[model samples]
Target: MSGSHLHSHDHAHGHVPVHSHGPASPHPAQAAPWSILRMTVVSRLAAAVAVSAAMWAVVWLSMR
Candidate 1:
């Protein structure tokens, strides 16, 4: 028999290590900072304004 046959291929191969550090975290939304949410809203608003400005520019140029 080969030396590789000595290796275990039963429950040892499917073992998952457990980890615990005190307690789990709270709700994801509650954990998130307000600045991140504000940045997202501001970015979306800026994008909408930019798109409207571009459309307006196109229409104004076409009127010439």
Candidate 2:
């Protein structure tokens, strides 16, 4: 082995690879209107509440 310290350095120590797809749009100009967005949110919330109420009713009836 050579006494020089230059050839003793390691190459597999610190190396990182980065990957990227593309940029995303925050809000496109052709996006849905505010009224439609409001209706969608309201319907989802209503459905979730209905499901919870139905589950509670079922459990209460079973325990009675």
Candidate 3:
């Protein structure tokens, strides 16, 4: 998330830098633990699969 405002490329003309335009989004990286945990299914494979399926169902319904 870094950039140069006035650099070689823009030096030729005139370039302006910009920052994130809107509200900061929840970083997907921060959710890595829960997401990974959800993916893991050694002893709880059945429950994990069920939860995943339900999540998909909700997402599909909401999208529709």
Q: Write the per-residue lDDT of candidate 3 for residues 1-64, one digit (tens) a residue.
A: 2785665454455566554454476524434445555554674787778899999999999999
Q: Which regions of candidate 3 fall more than 4 Å away from where they truly are? A: 1-43
Off by over 4 Å in 1: 1-39
What digit string (tens of lDDT, one per residue) describes model 2 on residues 1-64? 4785665667887776543432463533555555535667778789789999999999999999
lDDT of 2: 0.72
lDDT of model 3, residue 31:
41
For model 2, the stretches where C-alpha displacement exceeds 4 angstroms are 1-39
Per-candidate TM equals 0.39, 0.39, 0.34
Q: Candidate 2 or 3, higher lDDT? A: 2
Stretch of 10 with least lDDT, candidate 2: 19-28
lDDT of each: 0.72, 0.72, 0.67
Compared with the true structure, model 2 gives a TM-score of: 0.39
* Model with the higher lDDT, candidate 1 or 3: 1
